[model samples]
Target: MQVRDATATKSVRQGWTGRTRVALVVALVALLTASMPASGVYADQSGGDNNSGQNALNAQQRAVLYNIARDTWKFYSADVDPNTHLPLDNIGPNGKRGTYTSAANVGVYLWAVVAAHDLGLISREGARAEIAFTLIEVAKLARDHGFLHQWYDTTSGHVIRNPGDIDCATETTPTFDNCYFISNVDNGWYASGLIVVRSAMPELRGLVNTLLNPMDFGLFYDSRPQTACNVNPAVTGNQPTGQMFGGYYVGLPVEQGSNWQHYYHNGALYSDPRISAYIGMGLHQMPGDVWWRSWRTLPPKQCPTDPDFSWQGQWPVGGYWQVYKDPQSGKRFNVWEGHYTYPGSDLTFIPTFAGGMFEALMANLVVPETTWGTKSFGLADRRAAQVQVKYTTEQLKYPVWGMSPSSTPDDTGGYGGYGVEGLRFPYFGSGADASHPNLGLSQCHGCATEDVVTPHASFIALDVLPQRAYTNIQALRRLYPDLYRPDGGFYDAVNPTTGGVGHRDLVLDQSMIMAALDNALNQRKLQRHFAADPASAAAHRYLSFEKLSIADTGNGDNSGGDSTGNNNG
Candidate 1:
């Protein structure tokens, strides 16, 4: 399937008004100040106490987010040609058609819809209708060969490509991989879209099945072991062998190979905690829960450490190790621990995937007890039980937060080093107070660590659950609001070192941010029942977007002006 940019008939630039301009300036200034090199404040300082005087500001923020979601919905919905079931580009001034169907863009649009609904920014019915219509169109676009092309002409559901064109106007290869490499990001999006469809529309269960079932795609591997680069080179080289060994259980051999085929990294493999976190979450929504079980069953292994004490694997080594070891091995594999060649010793932080997977598992912890009827396998059962207890306890503790040390090669402060003596607590003792300017709220050592603020880190923080994840969410929301446009779009980077917002744009960043916000809001709602005091209640309400407003101004005057507008430009 061909992928093409949606045509821009009219300039969204004209939609910006003076008020938006002002808001943009103010917001940008605030963002810039927050990220200023001297400003070393961590965003979420209070662990679980949300009773700060920031309720009003929090409410305003929620309103802004809701408005952003609303604007996104209107933009996409308006572009969609109801009759053809295909989405067009932005509407031009004088009512002209701008561009054609964009598969990737539409996928993002659908996710925004899902996120809005989850955040309570849109009514359930509204979300359902939008998703239903979009899914139907998407289903129609799927070729008989099971590959979904990147773009289609909105006027006619036929696929379209860029101008340069190989065999222009004629059908080209109909493979998803052909459009993009077989990377986890692409697979994650495709998987996530399917999961959303399954969750929202039960009747469309077949679509989920279609995505899960592997076909005769040339890249398909039937049973392969996977490994990250930090593992023994012998183990890394035996990835194919491991996959072959585990072929019976894992079905297809998923390799961790990438263009950068080195012992330190894997391009094809997703090492970022954020992506893995979402993948784990999406896996929970699948039928029979094979992916979730596999994830839980996969033995963790130790490898050389990296700067952040975390490592993203390059190959499918964990699965292979598990197959060889046997299901009943009951061994705890430390996947993050890798033996690197040089300058790779600090990779001992908790498994990056742990936070994300833990978050997903927590979200679904309340799956009806009936769903667990008489399941076998002691480890699996035990893991579920542990997750249940942890999730239950966490929900009882609303606005949860975690306290961990940042990675700094110092005597008292470092990635794993608990600050001198009793300073390990949330508000790291008096020394933290004296050294860090933002009080405990902004000056935690962990925030400065590499893993805590990378795209992977942001992904993990946004996707995972537990108090720690929410704390990160709250921190980002407060500290880097500028990175997120008031219109539900987000710039790609948020500098962890300086807490500054980066100037890159990617549909993934916006989509992921929305997803994280949606998850946080949902968690807040779930934990509300356990609130014991007025403070907790306020905290829950504060994090919630339910009371937010989504009405549009006369022009595209989002209160924070077009910070995200110039992003695409």
Candidate 2:
């Protein structure tokens, strides 16, 4: 299928003049460091709470993760299309490759290959060959402003129209030429992987840069701050929007300032799409204030007509409105310092789109948010992990912990979103109300259910909850041995009630397992590789320096964040 790119591809450096690039850098630094107080400051000191947390894996834990990585790599080793080098989205019980792949699937596969080599599962030469083939085909695939379309035919590497996609073609009929939309989060993951591949295999740098450099992250950036907080049209007037959009339609007029869908602002800071903002800032495609634009929870505003008060999140919302100023334009933003609390507890944390483990931790696989924002994101990351553990094992009385989106655990083939229902916001497409306390096990109403305990969630938690993550994996094997597939790695999802498993291997899920192991086993090798990118340097301060208002509500204490360290044994 022939497709024209929205923007002509350029070299890694793009054609921006040196002066223009320097001005972007100046603007980014100003946003990160030059914030002046309007009413009260955001308590923006530096570092994260529990920054020193996360203990090293022990001998037994290392053996466990090593074996898991070795087994998980087998899925990619066999499931990839040899002619195209692109991985199929999944392999079902029939042991046949699935039809489609996404920017997220390919994105994680890039790092999976690097992780295999880093873990000694594959040689450097083998890893480079695999990555090179993938990039060569990717360069041939159609893209929007250097960003690949969301879905592509896995076998042929052509953009396909999927009706089931969250964002798909505007055309009613098949128009493979330029059918699909470009998703900010999907492309962010893809770009993040290229960043890792570029660093891990230096020999593949030129080919990788050919694909990575030209894709400007700024294309998806919605730089304007929103006029209101919650879903209130009247109060907000809904005009001045901010942050990144959910996605973009390459067919629609843009790159020329036609703001039709900029209103689809992904307001939450902890959502998966935050990766786009990170990459955009690093590339100087967006300003640093973009970080300040996303909501921890769209502050508990006076949207009285809306149900569940301002936001349909957990009750007794806790936070303050902290104002920040733009140094260049002198514009002020009333950033919400708000957060959600676990019912009957003071465990305060920022919520994700659906309270899924991957949503909270997927970006953590590459970006060192935990280390960079120890007081801010770092503290919230650790608390979120611990909350999942406590909620599942202690409250729900499940033998194993770790809740995330995965395939339905039933024998019939299916897929759906699963997460800690209490850990999300109903206002943000999550069925996260206190009334229903279902873990990722049984299907619930309203919230996108098919809630099954995905092992990948525990795997992703290796960075934050070192001890619990390791022990939980052991318990999973002990309680539900069928979940582990020694030959093809662990299956995707499991039913904690029954010994049922999803009996499938997904590229994205398996890749998360590989990446977490890569960092956990190799002393954060994947994160370090991505950190070396020039974009990472540009956004380091934004990640590192911040003091969030997420505090313990049990005793009404406001120590800023939980400083218990990285829950290591």
Candidate 3:
């Protein structure tokens, strides 16, 4: 197995003969694709809107997706903390045990377990026991107002706050004392998994509800953007730019003696953390217009020039201004459906903070964003996947296409923030003001020798770009025979050039693969589970009734006439 040692900082294991590589590629292709017919849905690429595209995956394709989920579930089924019953964050061929876990990992593990049963990998009783045990132990874990802390020791179910075992993005002091942050994004995933569990296994809804009842997504929401973030209504006529603050810092307030909420906000509406905001709005804990408050690419009026706008973004996007009226409040909001044009191409898309797959597509796992928001997020979701493919194959010329944040392709258990950085533009927002021009790890155009392929990323895009995703998965396994493990579908990450593999199975990644497969094969079982909830119904109109600038929906602003702003159409 070959791996990338970026910067030549460390030696990556490499031992592959040219002849051996050719033989493996030839042999593996036959085994994986031998059954598929050369003709039909596999060849056409129109985003799968036809009978052969999204309508149906051939029996062979369905079997392969199901089997992959079955294999991926094996990781979750076995990697349990005996005392806590919570899944470990990650494990290698025999990666050390008693490792730490996060709220996202624990939640995704629950989804994996339920999905395994839904796919018949486990019996109903077996799945119920697994989820019940994990929930019971989860009740014992420490929390702030029902939102789980970012990290917890798996074995003892203890909060790993002070000097937390993992890197704290908000690390402030040398002691890592500011490590205790309750993540809105992590809990969003946790709550998403709980919705799946409760909906799929009604017998256990009581236990799931006990844990969910106390959770108030509203605690993290701000109804007044003017009051919370000091945005003036004078500059922008407003319904209210009420937003969801990113997450909470447990300690470390502005004042030394008293406790105050220390928070960060996810300005990008497409980020994975939006999952928490979705859940909150679905349950009516948060206002529906908060949905409009998030920027499609930051409002054109205030972007780039506004002092409050984040310069660390793919700003100056092309889009249209539209208004969405909240039925609950009868207030109309001005919104920007801004999208980035793929450099040197006519296509436009909505890019995430890091231009990663899960960051853009993961929330779609439980919530059917593409199905309801067909004109808005759905179109963007398709563009998101397509641009990734075009950049990886057409531009970067990599043999495969799954670029996302995954383990660095080595045995060190290091993490890599890989993505189709050049999907549009290289990150230019690294400049302090405008002159210093620092290139942070934002976007990169044609940056080769540093790309990574994650199999879960392909699965994440399965709903949007099925055929390409399927083809890419086969390409990965064929080109690198070692990429697929015995019980796991594929290793976490791989270097396309060397076929180097990252052999760790992250619970979050594996669970994503399971949820994707479950959706593809079982007619969106998890999505149906979420849709069955009355709460999801409350959030339905917000998704279904809007027209984004990305495509023609015929009747623009479908939520009645635009009462507030000029139709920028």
Candidate 4:
């Protein structure tokens, strides 16, 4: 596998200079301190009676989102390789492939296809053809063991070889390499897509099962090749006991092989346990203990009470709290809250958004984190969604809302922060406004904060804050027409600083937008489909320890589980 030059890798972060960095800092302070208007501005535009604002706005947003998803289908069908039918990982303003494709893109494409078909955004026949074409392409890609490579050539369906700095590649010192490193999270996303597709069209069961079943996840967990770091440190009496926990390594390089050293985030691995645990549990790919034991040493949950910001409301972010142990001593010494790829010591006070708005909802869109056993994870989901909504209304002092870890139109990537009252982490990246002059170099599309507005985050929070989510969607369409595609869906994100929609259309972003919108409009159709599966059902059963009793179920309000039960299960 060939590795691209450092220049190619540095292209994403090419523009930010020290002057712009200072300007960005000033811009953030101004926006945060500036008074914001109320949420009623958009609600008042619903045309319907005040009481009907929510419903009317929802309907209006749904219509636009549906079209947007429909327009996005062309990228997978017409704009892709005619032979493979795999959409490019990115599309430029000129409608050309900006980069190679990847398993992550395919996974999202599959989800979008299902949503489009299920929601009647595309004809059934059209969807079946697209689905079949995509599956054939997936079958053709080179695989690490049985998993697809992180990135693929747009036309040949061959591996892209090097995907640069993204987590999909094997993280190596000096440089990251694509080298057919198998991505555990990418596989999970791909598998979830397969599950969703199978749920919709049972006819493809054999195909789905064949593609889904292979590949031993244990390979990623137990295999730790020798490096400067000790191999089997426990046996050498050099590593701590409980410090050796099992989880999937981020990826496996073709040459270096599958090992802890090749894992992403400097071999620390993703702390969002749900990526592998829940997916593996649902698919019966691994033992339930493999999933549950990861939390063997979690510290007790405590909601911080910070009056300046609503920290108390942001608990149990199920994904928060990485338990860092001294690899040699094996003593659990620290627990840091937030969705982080590295351990607790790596970040927290850097002023960076440790967890983007997207992290809060990406996995939840499918697994129903709202019902997960970790009470705080579920509570955080709702609170994060609510805070993000309010952030748009009251903090950003703009009409737009929702930020996540995404590339700004200028191609810089970072996490978004809600400029909430006292919670303003000055160095935190990714903020935007709907109105006002927050658009200067401080709000530069490509600033250090990776500041950009992503509607995908809003759509993901549909269940938690549908009204606010829908309101933002409408605002994006009505006020920021550049981000709105004629097909009714939105571009991957907007350079809110420049008020321009990005030229590139992202597959994963589209898939998320479609899935969230479909779930919002059709009574959570995608979630219900995913939950109905035995593997997902089994996983959820293990997770929902505080499920409601028969009395709670009888309350009509208790859909199925006990809503009032302790959420911190």
Task: Report the C-alpha displacement of residue 65, candidate 3, in angstroms.
Answer: 1.8
Angstrom error at residue 547, model 2:
1.2
Candidate 1's residue-wise lDDT over 130-206, tens digit each? 55545555556644234445445665666555412332245443322223222323333444455444444333444
Residues 185-236 of candidate 3: C-alpha lDDT, one tens digit per residue: 8998999888878778766666777778789998777554442222445423
Give the Å error, residue 80, model 4.
3.0
Count of clashes, each model: 45, 12, 1, 16
Q: Is candidate 2 or candidate 4 better by TM-score?
A: 2
Per-residue CA lDDT of model 4 for 269-322, tens digit only, reads 123335555666555555543332232212133322211111221221223344
Give the residue spans of candidate 2 off by over 4 A.
1-54, 163-178, 224-240, 254-263, 302-309, 325-332, 423-445, 552-569
Which of the two candidates, 1 or 3, achieves a greater TM-score against the reference?
3
lDDT of 1: 0.32
Better of 1 and 2 by TM-score: 2
Q: What is the per-residue lDDT of model 2 for residues 1-569, given as tens digits with 9 covering 90 to 100?
A: 11211111111123554345344534533442244322111122223332133455667768877888877777765667766768888888876568688898889999898888788876554565556657777888878678888688876677776623333334554332336467888899998998887667655556666677688877676654344444434423343245677777765633334445332567677867888888888777877667776677655554454333333444445678887665424567677777666655556677665667887888888887766766677667777777777666655667887888888886566888877655332333244444642222111224544247988998888777777777778888888888887776788888887778888888899999999998888777788777766657544666555567775322211123332322311
